[model samples]
Target: MIRTHQGINTDDDLKPDLTPLLDIIFIVMVFLLLTASVKLQSLDVDLPQTDTRTLQTTQADPITINLMSQSPYWALQGAAVEDWETFKTKLVEAVKAEPEKPVVIGADKTGSVENMLKLLAFLQQNNIKATQLLMEEEK
Candidate 1:
């Protein structure tokens, strides 16, 4: 028969033990630290890097090509291009005229990305490697 201890308080056994819980938590932490994986994702970008000394040597103005959100969406040197054919013709002439000048793509914030991609592909096809971009500063 089990001996009954009436004088002793039985509440001590009712209180939850924390040692096992803490040990499990530490085991989970160690497992996560060992099994976690880290990977870095990045893309190669072509960004213009200019120096003040180099700027002083070349005074040539950059050829600005604007991509608008409207019907006449393309602009070469601040003039709106009528159509794709005209844009190609004018761009070819401009590139040929000033081979040393950097081509700056100035796209409107509301403009479609398709136009920008087309412009980039055209530049690639024409082998215009020296290119820059213009973006409004975030206020």
Candidate 2:
């Protein structure tokens, strides 16, 4: 047992002070409430507004670019492309024929990743953003 400066041992001296703890908790709660209230009050938020009426759907058919194992070059539909230059020309022609048409790449499993990447990079260079990968449907 420890004695106070007066040289008397008492249970009152050993009692935990809860007033400061409660005060801190109350202060924190008030601060949180104030912050929450401020957040709840809506300010002038300039959120990006999208116009659904302006959204147009493309009526053109999707262009399919198939990477065959027979040759490293891509085939536009069933038409054979001799080189990258020829493929790009054909792709541009197709895109011109039907603007805003999406391109679907049918990459062969046997084809190298490097070739596929080259094709993708070429497409990106051509500013073709809408592209879909063709996959065999599971039965």
Candidate 3:
């Protein structure tokens, strides 16, 4: 009689394969790429170079809000506001008054991210959708 020893192939003895996990990761990546919003962040608010301009429309000019951290100033349409709360209230009122009008944010490079985030949150909470970034010209 000959005795043969069989090798164990139990789950505890075998290592889990990573191929399925990699496949799942790839699938998630593809889904995100398909559903993600793609915007030009590098030039998000950068001013464009234009030579000729057409006549302006009757639509209300977008309100421009500038943020400066070093000096800590808030401006609405080139005029300075007293405080952030006031700025937020005025912004809300402006949007409420003219839902169709847009808000343009001119953020300084030295500004705090908190300020920008606050402004963004305010706009989002108010259901304002016509907000845009304003960048200065590169020189």
Name the top lDDT candidate: 1
* 1 versus 2: better lDDT goes to: 1
**Whose TM-score is greatest here?**
1
How well is each residue in 65-122 modelled by candidate 2, as lDDT tens digits?
7776656456786566878788889888887787666676666766667878988898
**What lDDT score goes with residue 104 in model 1?**
67
lDDT string for model 1 (107-126, tens) is: 77677789889888988998
lDDT of each: 0.69, 0.65, 0.64
Q: Please identify model 2 stretches exceeding 4 Å from their true place.
A: 1-60, 137-139
lDDT of 3: 0.64
Error of 2 at 40 (Å): 52
Model 3: colliding residue pairs: 45-135
Error of 1 at 90 (Å): 0.6
Clashes (candidate 3): 1
The per-residue C-alpha lDDT of model 2 at residue 86 equals: 85
For every candidate, C-alpha RMSD to the true structure in Å: 17.9, 19.1, 13.3
* lDDT for predicted candidate 2 compared with the true structure: 0.65
